[model samples]
Target: MRYEETAQLENPRSSVSTDMMVGTALYTLAIGVFFVVFGLRKRQRWIVFWGATMVVAGAAYVVAIALGVDK
Candidate 1:
């Protein structure tokens, strides 16, 4: 039997581009907004909470990218 090992880099380069990241962030923000609105209409507190969490995360991701945190 032969054993194979996977090597991991200390500082791996990200293949995701700025445009792709922005697009992903925007999509997440949109979904969060949808969840928040739907939850409000349905009066679901848990859903609202989760939606708000997603909103914050999406916004933070955008801010982080803008600040060059990815680098």
Candidate 2:
């Protein structure tokens, strides 16, 4: 592709709607919650750690979207 054309390429994130982003983030949060719960029940520390990370990331994403900082 030409340099100009590449430079003009659209950002995939720019095309995503707020609703879709929120939905995805919410889904991530749900998965995280599930992992945390399941890990606790299974006595698995790693699973809980990953789940907490996911929860933090999802929450951050939601906050970023709300604050209009995603752009």
Candidate 3:
């Protein structure tokens, strides 16, 4: 499925609150940062991959909120 469609499907009820959405976005961003830092220090490909993935996830979460999918 497409990213936007997947997001909509995952959050079908649209009952998520602003605080919860913000928290999830923050958590994902933090994880992304951690992975990027660890990847740079340890030179692990997986860490970098996870970091990029988290960044995308964070962006998607924000987009979903902006699109009013999880209101």
lDDT of 3: 0.85
In model 1, the number of clashes is: 0
Tens-digit lDDT track of model 3 for 1-71: 66554333653665777888779897998899899889989999999999989988998888788898964
Q: Where in model 3 is the C-alpha error above 4 Å? A: 1-16, 67-71
Candidate 3 residue-wise lDDT at 60:
89
- Tens-digit per-residue lDDT, 1-71, candidate 1: 98898898997887987889889888888899999999999999988998898899899999999899988
Off by over 4 Å in 1: 1-15
Score every model by TM-score. Answer: 0.72, 0.72, 0.61
Give each model's whole-structure lDDT. Answer: 0.90, 0.90, 0.85
Q: What is the C-alpha RMSD of each candidate to the true structure, in Å?
A: 3.3, 3.9, 10.3
lDDT of model 1, residue 45? 90
Clashes per model (N, Cα, C within 3 A): 0, 0, 0
Candidate 1 residue 65 Cα shift, in angstroms, is 1.0
